[model samples]
Target: MKTAVIYNSDLHFEHKQWESELAFWKDELKSFNNRLGELVTRWTDKDVLAQLEHYQNEFILHGNVIEDLQEAMEKHEMNISEHSNKLGDTMDVPMFSTHKEIREKMETQRQIYADLKKDFFRFLSKYM
Candidate 1:
């Protein structure tokens, strides 16, 4: 089966930064799964199943480390804008050109992220 993908020059440049985050999220997810299995085996509390379900649902998004990095990248845009504005205020720089390019790139990334969400949720629901 084919899969949706997200990519950008910024993403490529920050791949190493995201790698650690991805590893951490995956490790946490595996730990959660292990704990869930233990909870299932114990059959000690009635609410355990509900808690497990909640955790499973939560982990679905938590496992999306790329989303986290994308968010950080987005925040960086604000800083870039501020710095650029400072420069523009002090000197004559066509800020619009840079802003326009970044905006277009961001919009494209957002679309890809949306597509990824759709595919992930669709596939997950099928198995769930």
Candidate 2:
């Protein structure tokens, strides 16, 4: 019983961390968009313009992905809250698996974002 409580507590902490991370990434995306805007006025080459457009679209898509992940986390948290309210500190088995799935999704997003940053930096180095 004590261990279950600890496990659930850890899961809650992870969810909070993920929420914080997503928020940070969202802000970073805004900064990226602003940098792209700056690049737009300085560069008139068709290829540079095309790359900028691609990045703009990528940022938008990533923003949407972050939003969807946030919604999923919120729903998961709500489900856990509702379950605990009805049944004490014990969590449902499915909740554990669901948490695992969310963790994987977060990891995947982090990797993808890292790659995007690398590519964006390389682009800036070449063109800026």
Candidate 3:
């Protein structure tokens, strides 16, 4: 038997807000992908080697876009996620779903690259 469960009065509003947030993020991701593609198209073998050198010289220049993406994720964690508190009450808001796992993983890879800069420096220093 199926039971008809009724949601809270605010559920409708929350649904609308959730839809809007999903749409906004979808657009944002599309834009980001387009920009990334443009960068890839402009990238040549020489450009790739030069960028590698630049990264070796300036660690701070690396992973800036990755950081921006992480900030976006953090913003979602702060503003969107609604989990239970100590009182065992739910926060009645919709957070990103598991489908966003890919995005999270990509960000993690970027972070790894950022961390690798330290290793790169250490390796270079040993040769000096």
Quote each prediction's TM-score: 0.39, 0.92, 0.32
Please write out the lDDT profile of model 1 over residues 26-110, one tens digit for every residue: 6756765666666567656556566557656756655564465556555655555465456532212343344345456545644
In candidate 3, residue 91 scores what lDDT?
A: 35
Q: Clashes per prediction?
A: 0, 0, 0
Local distance difference test, each candidate: 0.52, 0.89, 0.45
Which candidate leads the pack in lDDT? 2
Q: Candidate 2: how large is its RMSD?
A: 2.3
What TM-score quantifies how close candidate 2 is to the native fold?
A: 0.92
Off by over 4 Å in 3: 1-52, 56-61, 81-94, 98-103, 118-122
Ranking by lDDT: 2, 1, 3
Residue 41, candidate 2: alpha-carbon lDDT: 97
User: Residue 61 lDDT in model 2?
Assistant: 91
- lDDT against true structure, model 1: 0.52
Query: Can you write out model 3's per-residue Cα lDDT over 15-89, one digit (the tens) per residue?
Result: 455445445544544554454445446556675545445543444333344455445555544443343233233
Query: Can you list the residue pairs that collide in candidate 2?
Result: none
Candidate 2 wrongly placed segments (more than 4 Å): 1-6
- Kindly give the stretch of ten consecutive residues in candidate 2 with the minimal lDDT sum: 1-10
